[model samples]
Target: MSAVASVVSLVELLRGNPGSCRWTGGLSPVDLARAERELGTPLPPSYRCFLAEVGSCEVDGTDFLGVYRTPAMGDTLLGTVSGTLDARTDPRFPPDLLLIQYDGMGGLVCLDLSRRDRAGEAPVVVWDPGSADRGGPERLAADFGSYALRQCTQALTRGG
Candidate 1:
């Protein structure tokens, strides 16, 4: 199956039976395009599809970041992807690393924009804050689709 198709299917499955994942509908195309322009790079296919077809979600209790403000959710806006990525709140965090989501237990899930894997997409990695300056980030998946599906599997195991 195509990457987008597979990612969409996974989202469907997770939405149907997500344990603690807070899933939501996809974002509008216009908003996603704006985000891409602001980020200065085209998003990977899986993430692009997810944002355009699945919006924000909290899979396995971890809140995934979204790109635009949703009207349904008022002033308490979580934030757009660009905002989170550009924040660089911590000096230890690499500038090329984009924070996607943070697991409740203090580990952050992020994508490396500096290099793209053979599949022409940035790889996702888990950054541990506890060992902040000691070691390198651990690889999560080759791409966002793989990462999301893995998380969905965990959700099913826990909630299904």
Candidate 2:
């Protein structure tokens, strides 16, 4: 199956199952485009398809966290809390990359997704898989999905 198809199927499964965290729609197309322009890179294909077909939704697992898609622009807004892990020590973390794109063809691309936080002292690294350097998009997607699921489970149990 195509990457986009796989993601859509996954969404369907999540939508049908109450055990998994639910997703609420996210940023609008204008916002997604703005983000893309600001970032100077296109979003991943699976993410694009996700935005188009699934749109965005608040995940039931994690309060207020979600993956949003923009059908018009074919972009995705991954709204989740940022987690930090020192790549040097964390074996599970991938290398630092601004954005990672996975085409479901066993191909992964990493883009620089660093931006200055509100404090502006240091840049915030969104996804860093434990490698000494940045890893592929598939890796980031997998890691983020895993983290989201774990957080969702916790949130559901806490009734958050």
> For candidate 1, lDDT tens digit of each residue in 1-160?
5455668777777667655566666767777776776666677777888887777777656567855465776533344464455456666666666667776677677777777766557788877655456677888787777777777777667754
Reference-based TM-score of each model: 0.77, 0.42
Query: How does candidate 2 score on lDDT?
Result: 0.40
In order, what is each prediction's RMSD in angstroms? 3.2, 12.1
- What is the alpha-carbon lDDT of model 1 when measured against the actual structure? 0.69
TM-score of 2: 0.42
Candidate 2 per-residue lDDT, tens place, 42-135, comes to 5545444444444444344333322344475354344321111112244544333433233234332333234322322122123324233545
Reference-based lDDT, each prediction: 0.69, 0.40
